[model samples]
Target chain A: MSTILIIEQVLNGLQFGVMLFLMAAGLTLIFGVMGLINLAHGSLYMVGAFAAAAVAGATGSFFLGLVAALAAAALAGAVIEMVVIRRLYAAPHLDQVLATFALILIFSEGTRWVFGSFPLFLDIPVGLAGPVTLPGGIEYPLYRLALIGIGLAVGLGLWALIERTRIGIQIRAGENDREMIAALGVDISKLYTLIFALGAALAGLAGALVGAIQSVQVGMGEPVLILAFVVIVIGGIGSIRGAFIGALLVGLTDTLGGVFLPELFKLFMETGAAQKSGSAIASMAIYILMGLVLVWRPTGLFGARG
Target chain B: MKRFLMAAAATALGASSAAADIKVGMITTLSGGGAGLGIDVRDGFMLAISQSGRDDIEVVIEDDQRKPDIAVQLSDKMIQSERVDVMTGIIWSNLAMAVVPAAVNQNVFYLSPNAGPSPLAGKGCHQNYFNVAWQNDNLHEAAGAHANGAGYSNTFILAPNYPAGTDALTGYKRFYEGELAGEVYTKLGQTDYAAELAQIRASGADSVFFFLPGGMGISFLKQYANSGIDLPVVGPAFSFDQGILQAVGDAALGVVNTSQWNKDIDNPTNAAFVESFQAEFGRLPSLYASQGFDTANLLISALEAADPSDADAFREALRAADFDSTRGDFAFGPNHHPVQTIYAREVIKEGDVFTNKIIGTALENHSDAYAADCKM
Candidate 1:
């Protein structure tokens, strides 16, 4: 590959990594603070995408649709937290998993009932519709570039929220010692709900942003959810910084692997066999990375707890 | 002893009366990501059955959830308990492979509305199996011919890494007379194409050929449109079908795709089917829907000649292939797979709706490559 091509692939990897970080950040925060295995988080992502598509179709404004996505997902997250998740905190992980798994089914069927089985249309904003010539004469999609900037900004914003704000301290403290925070006059339940909603909104934002490029349809979140879980595990559970780094690592590994693995194999094997074996291994590269990371550091790169 | 005699008599009477009724069990994906294709096939099949006004044709539909194991289980249930005389309404090739051979072996007529896997068309072909749809590779082969017609050389081709995916690339290369710039196999059910698109951009190919179906196609097309590579794209009709074209929006516009049937196929049955389907379902009929309609019609035509219980006579009737297909001049090859014309369609916008208009004939009177291998 040429230097220009490698640069372009790197940019693509960064874009994908940033997007994964959005989903992973929310999941890690929710798991870290609540200690509940929420399988329905992906459903919330789907909710955001569907809501954005609907509002955007109705209003013809991408910005308004994004706002709708955040509101709808947050509202859905808050309501779910109060009605279902509130009761699950004291429950075992298996019970939490089962309940949230049911939520995924309910949310999926409910969305299908409303939107029908066909995927919805959601395009990038007209201003970001085409590509831009970057430095070194590389032409890249402006929307993807914007996605990277937005993801990084969100990452910074989330970091500030967790580090600089009072709520951030309570969240961190709650992650450390929930009983102590509860005894210190903090309404842990309310904080849990707020954290869930905040995490949900981030997932929703990712959904809305990615939905513009990808098809906005039911079951869209499950794949991303799996990747996000991998991200948090690699970053260390409940660590936003870890999640960010892990997301980037997973993203870069996946993208670069898909492009280069086949070429690497081509050098040593027949063309057809190389493509087949290369792609077969590339699809598993992320899981291999995860396994290696766990072997090296079981808690993850940034995971504080065992 | 008296009660047992009476129950036996009642059972005999019920069996005699039920002999006239033809029970068809349809196991299709009605939920999950691939639901759209199955729904269209079901709707079209149901529409034809309803229009026939045959109350004796009892149709039992079940959702397979797009799982092969579930499909196998459903087929077993239909064959054993439901005692369905005819089985149909499978959408995916893998699911068809799981269900068709076994169902046909059980003496149940398996009329395929969609998904004609190559195995069933070749040495594994059964007398009771009939594929109303083109073989899985037919459209891809047509796409290859269309690419040649469009004068695209050094094409970059890609497909998901699976059995059917391998078949797609193999089919394309079988007919395409051009040098390939690159060949990549993407992960199945992959949503992102950023890496692949980057490769495409740098490949220096004059055109791109891909065979990703369903939402995978939508993602690829949208990402490709935005990537600004602007290379001409060609593919089978699965991606550009009526059910998916709306979601794909303007990104799909002006793209050439190949299919065996279109709404504008210039046949009386097709025109009426398209109109009534829109009237019934409030949307244009997809190619899957058309296949479903034709499948039902073929079954009805066979039923007119002989009862399904009479396997030999019914088989002969089906072999006659006398039916008004949505695609005109419909007939099965020796292997019971479709031998029909494949047309190249260009995606176009008519007002706000997205649909296909027939551009030209990609392959005339095309039959599958596997037909020669069929001993049956």
Candidate 2:
């Protein structure tokens, strides 16, 4: 491949990785602080996508649609947190998983009921509709480039929130000792809701951003949800930094493996054989990487031991 | 709610002991990922029956949830418990492969509206199974024919790594005599196409042909447009069907796709069907919808000819294919697959709606390649 092609693929990887980080950050944050496995996280992502698509189609404004997505998903997260998730907070992980899984069905069916089974259209804004030429005569989609920037900004912003702010300190403290914080007059339930809403907002933002290029439809979040789980698992269960790094690793591996594995295999094997085996391995590359990581560090790359 | 109504209608009908109530069981995906296609098929079939006001037919509709095992279970229940005389309305090829064999084996006539897998057209073909839609390979073969006629020498092909995908590529290769620049298979339901686009960009291919139905096609076409790839793209009509064309929108405009039916087909039956469907559903009918409408009318006409109780008469009536099809002049091949016209449709923006207009005929009186394999 040429340098320009490689650069383009790298950017694609970064763009994909950024979206994954948006999803993984929220999931990891929830699991870290609340210790509840949220299987419905993907449903929240779908909610954001549908909301954005609907608003955008109605108003013909991408930014307005995005804001709506953030608002809708946060509201949904907060509402569910208070109503259903709050009850599951004291329950076992299995119970939490089952409850969230049930939420997935409700959200999926409910979205279908509202939006119908067909996919909705969401166009890229006129300003970002086309490609921009990059350095070394490379061309890339401006919207995707914007995604990378947003991901980095969000990553830095999350770091500041967790490390440099008072709420961040309280959150960190809650993660360490919830009972101590509660005894110290910190409203743990409200804090949990805020955190859940914050995570939901991030996922919503991700969904809105990706929906421009992908069909905004039911079950859109499912594949992304599975990938986000893989990202968090590899990054460590509760670490944003780990999630960030892990997300990038996965995006790069998946993007590059899919592009190059077959080509690389072709150098040593016949055409048909290379294409078949290369894709088979490429599809399994991330899982294989996970297995190797688990063998080395059971908790994950940055996971802490209980 | 629809199922409840159907059940209630059947119960009220059962009280009459009319014996003319030809129990028609339709098992299709009504929920989950591919629900849109199945919903269209169901609506179109029901529309035809409802428009005719035929109380002699009792249609039982069930959702398969797009699972093979569930489809198999529903097939057994519909065949044994419901004791349905005829069964139809499966959308996916795999589900058809799973349920068609057992349903037909039990002597239940299976009328396919959407999926027409090649196996069912070949040695596995049954006298009781009739495919109203084009065989899975027909549209792809038409696509290949279109590409060859357009004079594309180096083409890149991509499809999901499944049986239908394999059939799609094989069908294209069967007609198109060209040098393949590259071939690739992607994961089913994969939304990302960045890697594949990159390969398409680098492969020195002059054109691209792909078969990714539903959301997969939308994702690929949208990404391909965004990536600034300027290759000529063609594929079967599934990706360009009415349900998803709006999502693909401007990216799909000007792209050619092959189909067995289009709204613009010049026929009285098609004109009436389209007008009535639009009035009933407040949306233009898709190819799947047309197939469903035709399948329902076919069954209705057969019912008019002979009762479902007479196996030989009913099979012969269905094989005659005397009903007016939306595609016009449609007949069944020896293997019971549709021998009909395949049209090339170009995605065009009609006002604000994204829909297809007929460009040209790709195949006329086309019969599936595997029909000769059937001994019966």
Candidate 3:
């Protein structure tokens, strides 16, 4: 491939990787600190998208809609954690799964009831609607580039929050020993709430950002949540750094595999057979990568052993 | 105590002497992913029946949840126990295929409001099964012919990896003479299209035709717009409709869709339907709703024309296609599928609603190409 096309593909990969990271970060955080598996994380994402769409429609301001998305997601996260999620922290994983699954059903149905079964569209703001030429002369969507930038900023901000802040220290302490931290007079319950809300905001932000590019509707978040789970598992569960790396790897692998696998197969097979086989294998590539990674590093590349 | 006994005796005598109501069992996807379509069918049929001033037909609705097995089981219950003379209402192709065969086997006349899958339209055409909707492939074929006429030489086809998807692509390719740049089949219920978008961007095709319905359509249109690819796009009506318009918004503004009905069809009947539908539902009626309304009218007309009590007579009357459909003068082909005009529609925003306006008709006096292939 030409250097220009190669550069463009790499950029495309980065964009995808960054988006995955946004989804993975909150998922990993919630799984790590809360010791609670939330299947409804995607529901929160859907909530954010709906909130953004609603607000954007009301005010005709995409920026305000985005802000509302983050706020709404965080608020929802807090409320859910306080009311329903609090009861599940000490519950069995099966119970957690069932309850969260129920939450998903309720959220989806409630959203449908309110929104009336049709998808709410979030328009790309006029400022970012046009295409921009990249360094390699690739005409990329400005909104997509903004998403990459947003994802990167969120990732870095999350890193700083976890590494440098006092809340970060408490979170780390809680992750290491929840009971001991409680004994040491830290508000462990409040910490959990804060972390959960923060994680939810990240998910919400991801949803809202993606919502501008996609339709905002019920059950829209579930597929992305599945992929995010896959991302975090590959990245090493409960590790922010791992999630970042894993998301990028997954994003790049998925994007490049989809495009190049068919071309690679064409070298040895007939065109039609090559295309079919290639596409099939490309979809399976990341799962295979995750499997191979598990074989090599059972705790993942950066996972903490219990 | 004597007075209460006398009143109870009189009420009991009145209840037992009342004529048995004609019960119709309507199985549809009333919940989960396919709920919207089923709801539209239910509401449209209810509206039509209500407007018709017919209280004789008592409809019992059941949710099949888009499962073929559930649909078949529901059909069995409706036919065997309830002994519903007529069975109707299915939105999904697989569900319709499953349930209709069972209904036919039971010697019950099946009136399909939507989902006229091709196999049933062809060799499997049972006299017992009648569809008020056009054959599934017919509209896509119109799109393909239109795309070919418009001089799209190198086209890319995308669809979910499923029966309906395969049927749609086959229909399009049957009429389209373009050199296919590529045909991509993504996983069913896939939400992310970034990878596919990248591939499409790289494929260098002049036009892209896809057959993603409902939620899939919304997701695909949104991602396609985000990818910054400027190729002309076309699909059947399901790709761009009232059910999905808000989800797609202005993204579908330039996309060309082919359909048997558009909201902007200038006819007195359609205009009246639209006005009343919007008044009641607070939204424009989707073509699915229109088909549902038409289905109701068709059944009523056929019932009026023949011996309503005879299932055989009702089936024959329905196949005769004697109803005045809002889509103008259209008759059912021998296979019990509508032989009607296919119009090319463009998605344009009017006020807050996204609606498909008829731009042109692809075929005038067009019968489905597959009709001759059906020896039934």
Candidate 4:
């Protein structure tokens, strides 16, 4: 591959990774603070995508639709946290998995009930549509480049909030010791809801943005959700910093693996067989990476004991 | 009111007429990723059966959920319990391969509404099985023909890595005289194609052919349109069909696709079916729907000639092909798959809706390449 091609692939990987980070950040945060594994995180992402598509279709305003996505997802998350999640805090992991799995079904069917079986279209805003030529005569989509920038900005913003703010301290404290914080003046329940809503809103934002490029339909979020789980696990669960790095790593591995594996295989095998085997291995590249990472550090790359 | 009339007819025919009942058990994907296509097929099949007003035709429908194992189980249940004489309405080829072989072994007349996998067209062909749709390879071959006719020299071809995907590319290559710029098989259900699109843009190919069905096609087309790569794209009708066309929107406009039928096919039966389908379903019928409707009609026509209980006579009647098809001229080949015309369709805006209109014929009186291999 040429330097320009490699650079483009890297950009594609980064764009994918950044989107994964948006998902992983919330999931890790929820896991870290609430100590509850929420499998319905992907459902929140779906809610956002549907909300964006529906609102944008109605108003023809993409910004307002994005706002609606965030609001809808956050409100839904807050409601779900208060009702079902609060009851499940002390429940076992199996119960959490089952309940959240049930939520996934409810959300999928509920969305299908509202939108029917057809996929909804979400157009890229006219201004952001099309590609921009980079240096070295390389062309890249403007929206994707913009997503990378947005992801970085969000990452930085999240770091600032977590490290430099009062709420960040309380969140960190809560993560460190929920019982100790509860003994102090902190209203642990309200904080948990806020944190859950925050994580949910981030997922919604990712969904709304990605929906513009992909088909907005039921079960869209599940694949991304699985990838995000991979991201968090690899980055070290409950670490925002780990999520950031892990998302990029998985993203790069997936994108570059998909592009390069077949070419790599072609060197040793016949062309058609090479392409087939290369793609087969490439699909499993991320999972293989995760396995290696876990073998090396069971807690993840940045994970530490509580 | 319709229920009352059906009830009245049922009583007149006698409730004890189970022996004469031409029970058709349809197992199709009804609740998963490509559920929309299966739903359309089911509706179209039901429309034909309901229109025939045959009280003796009792249909039992089961949801396959797009699972091959589930399809096998449902087929077993339908054959053993429902005792369906004529069975139809399977959409996926994998599901058909699983269910057709086992079900047909027990003397069930398997009339395929869709999913004409290649093995069945050749050495794996069964006397009890008949494909009402065009063989799976026909549409892609027609696409290759269209690409050749359009004077494309080097084409980048892509499909998912599965039996159908392999068949699609092979079929394209059989007819396509152009130099292959690249051939790639992506993971099935892969929604993102930016990496693939980047390769296509760089490959310097003059044309592109892909065969991703349902949501995969939607995502690919949307991503490709924005990639700013202006290469002319051609493919089979899986992506261009009515169910997902609205989701694709203007991104799919001006693209060419190949199919055996279109709503605009110049036939009276085609015209009548299109109008009634829209009237009943409040949506345009897809190629899948057309296949389902044709399959149902074919079954009905065979029933007119012989009872399905008499397997040999019914099979002969089906081979006679007495039914009028939505596509003007259709008949079963020696292998019992369709030997019919495949048309080239161009996606165009019909007022507000995005759908295809037939631009020209790709292949006339086409039979599959595998017919000679079939011993049957």
Candidate 5:
């Protein structure tokens, strides 16, 4: 209700939006370039966290763990692409979904088997663990602020990668005409592997960064993955720019909705009744936003028409 | 003709042996999000069975995959094909609600190791169902009492939007004789809590009580620490259990929770249990494991008190409160739930171990507040 509270909610929303963008950029890019609807993308995110945790625990250096996360995820992605995903490109979406879903099962079970059914701790490194004061006497986490920075930098880096590099051109070409790109003597398989690995690494980076603020456990990436999907879907599947905007929109909507809806409901109902109704409606707000977006622009805000 | 007669004789022997074997089926969230709690229950139950040396106890363990449909299917198979005499280990309430009714339909005793849904604690209670854990409402009630006793007025409550969360807030409100500043029902397994935390800070509640367990707990605690919301955070045992200890670590320090068991509880039985659990698991045992250990011990006591050769006899013995629990003196209530002490504890750093150390015992011989509401 207060201007200060509204500002704080918006900042909170932006931070969440940034995190979702980190997840969605890789996902949408992978989908756009590889033509793979990977259900196992979340598993790669898990891999990143596990890798980060293992390395960080071993090294006691969060920085090293982050690097390890990127390498591990990329390696895992490449290997999976070479062995499993390469075969699935020609397969139907259902088959791809099933195979990737199996990968999620295998990854989750395997992580549990290795880590032993318990969540691993990844800390916000010593200095970043504290809070930073914002405008209007509000305090925000230093690590989350760092994440917002990292997410923006990564987004910019991703945009540059796709728009400013030879590989980026090849990827865009592959997206536009895979057969044409292959006919032009480009090693499409290698390109696909590179894109997949890059996407995986990005996912892993997000996982490692987020894991510091959460638990690094099996299936940890799932809920975020769903949100990332929602982001990409709303942004237009394939558009990194759209992912950023869409993620922020969703983050703000979800965050502000949860807070304000209940207060709004309180105007007409008892406190408890207002909260129950408000929370229920707020929880659905993002999906509603997504639905409305779809109703208006079926392909998404930035999606290419077939 | 001789082969046929030999086959007939083996079939008769097999039938008799099958009748003698006590089939126990377990359905838990052995995979996905609920795996941490489910695995502890599974391990404790297995350890107890191993300790019992009861080779006749055949436990067919199945992962519910945290899906109700899968749980129903697995329970159905165990009931119809395996014909399990005693069934146990359902972690989630929905899974239990889905599977327990089916077990009750078959007249099989469903020993719930966790998740004592309120409905089962009341009107929907079946004679065949026994809950080893506290009624899902008991722990949160302790939290409410703790908050009230600690002078936390106008507290904001946050929980995942689910049956357990609903029950948890209800439990808190039952004991919390204070103005509720606000209550936010978040998405179950929400990774991000900054939005909610910001709102909580803005709402200016004196304290925030939450019921996020497992990974959600870790995220909430971490985010809360990050948000620098200096309010005293409180919740039930699962919010700061061993499963999330290392995950939350020092961030969880100063956070208060209420539970039925703490590893540091001074008791001979708990001492022995803790030592062995640490030795075996190489980590501290969670309350879920404690419930599982109690379930195992309770089952063993029932077996000892009953005619194991007769399934119906064993069920009656189990219902008759046959166990000396690890939680000192405890017994199953008429609705087949534990009426036990609930302790309020703070997450503390005990050298290398980051776990809850009991600071207060809120309810001594406290039955669930919801029990009176239940006619059954």
Candidate 6:
């Protein structure tokens, strides 16, 4: 590949990685603070995209749509936490999985009922509609570049929130010992609700931002949800730093593997067969990376718990 | 107790009307990512049956959920329990492969509204199976012919890696008569096209051909539009259909696509179908809907000739293909696949609506390559 193409691919990988961090951050935070496996995280992502699409279509304002997405997803997350998730805090992981899985179905069917089965239209805003030139004469989509910037800004803001605030201290304490934090002045239930809603808002924001480029449809979140899970597993289940690093690693591996694997196979195999086998391997590249990570460090690159 | 009583009464009604009744079980994706296509097909089929005002035709529709195993189970239930004499409404080729052969083997007449995989069109062809839609390769082959007509000598091709995807590339290459700059098989259901678009940009190709259907297509078109590659794009109609064109927005505008039917086809049946479809469903009919309409009309024509229980006569009646299709001239090849004209359609925005208009005929009197392999 040419230097320019490789540079472009790296940029694409970073863009993808940054988006994954947005998703993985929330998932890891919820698991860390709440000690609950929220399988309905993807549903929240869908809710955000749908909310954004609906508002954007009605008001013809992308900014207002994003605000609606955050509000709607956070509201849904808070409501779900209070109504359904609260009951399952002490339940087994299996029960939590079943309940959240049900939520995915409900959210999917509910979104389909409201939005209809057809994918809703959500485009990049007019100001960021086309590509822009970068250093060394590389042309990249302005919206995607903005996405990377926004994702990194969110990441930095999240770090500040967690590291420099009293709420952050309480959240970290909860991750360590929930009973101890509850024993203190903290109202643990309210804290849990806040954390869940916050995490959900992050997922929603990611959904709305990505929805501009991707499809805004039912079950859109599930695929990204899978990737987010892989990210958390590789980054360490409850570590934001780990999630960030893992997200970038997975994204780069996926994008680069997809581009190079087929070419690599073509050197040894026929063109068609090489393409097929290369794509097949590329699809499994992230999982294989996870496997290698686990083999090397079972706890993950940044995971604390065994 | 009320439910049980209702079931008994329905069974009694079914028994009483058994002589002249034709039961059709439609198994299709209705509740997931690919639900739009299935919903359109079901709407079109039901519309035709409703317009016919035939109480004798009992249609049982079930959502396949785009799962092959579920389709197989539904087909079994329809055959054994519901005792449906005819089956239709499968959208995907893999699902058709899962359900069609077994249904036809059990003597249930199969009328495919979409998804005519080459296996059923060739070596696996059965007397009871008929495809109202074009063969899976038909539109892609036509797209290739259109590309040649457009004078594209170097092209970049990509498709999701599956049987249908492989078939799409093969079909394009069969008539393309051009040097391929690059050919890539993308992961099925892949949403991102950044890597592929980069490859396309650097491939030095004059045009791009892709065959990502449903949501995948929506994602590809959106990303490709923003990628600044600006290469001309051509593909089969699945991406540019009425059900999805709105979601694609302006990114799909002026892009040429190939299909066996379009709303602008100059035919009385097509015009009426489009007008009434919008009136009934409050939306334009897609190509899948047209296929469903034609399938239902084909079944109606056969029912007019003879009962489906008489396998020989019903099969012949269906083979006669005497229904007025939305695509105008329509017939069945030796393999029971559609022999029809495939058109080149340009996506155009009328007001706020994104729809296709027929630009030219890509292929006339088109029959699938697999037809020659069918002995029957």
For TM-score, the strongest prediction is: 6
Q: Which window of 10 residues has the lowest lDDT sum in candidate 3 chain A?
A: A1-10
DockQ of each model vs. true complex: 0.79, 0.72, 0.41, 0.71, 0.75, 0.87
lDDT of 6 at B7: 100
Expressed as tens digits, the lDDT of each residue in B1-376 for candidate 5 is: 9999999999988976775557778888887767889989988778777867786677789899989999999988988988777789899888888889878877788888888899888888877788888898898999999988899988999888888989999999999999987788887777888878777887879999999978889888888887777898889988788887887877889888898988877878788888888888777889899889888888888878775457678777887776656688777776777878889898888889888888889988888655565554
Q: Residue by residue across B27-136, what tens digits does model 6's lDDT show?
A: 99999889999999999999899988887898999999999999999999999999999999999999999999899999999999998899999999999999999889
What residue pairs clash in candidate 2, if any at all?
none
Best by DockQ: 6
The DockQ for candidate 5, computed on C-alphas, is: 0.75
Residue B319, model 3: Cα distance from true site in angstroms: 0.7
- Taking the tens digit of each residue's C-alpha lDDT, what string does model 2 give over A38-113? 9999988998989999999999999999999999999999999999999998899999999999999999999999
Candidate 2, CAPRI quality class derived from DockQ = medium
Question: In angstroms, how far off is B226's CA in candidate 2?
Answer: 1.5
TM-scores, one per candidate: 0.97, 0.97, 0.93, 0.96, 0.95, 0.98
* Ranked by TM-score, top first: 6, 1, 2, 4, 5, 3
* Docking level of model 1: medium
| Sliding window of 10 residues with minimal summed lDDT for model 5 chain B | B367-376
Better of 1 and 5 by lDDT: 1
Of models 5 and 6, which has the larger TM-score? 6
Q: Residue A159 in model 5: shift from native, Å?
A: 1.7
Candidates 3 and 6, the one with greater lDDT = 6
User: In candidate 5, what are the lDDT values of residues A1-306, reduced to their tens digit?
Assistant: 778678777887888888888888888988888778988889999999999999998999999999999999999999999999999999999999999999998999999888877789888789797788887776778888888899889888988988999988998898889999999999999998988899899899989998988878898887888888999999998888999999999989988898889889999998777888898999899999999999999999999843
Please state the error at residue B254 of candidate 2 in Å: 0.7
Global lDDT of each model?
0.93, 0.91, 0.83, 0.91, 0.86, 0.93
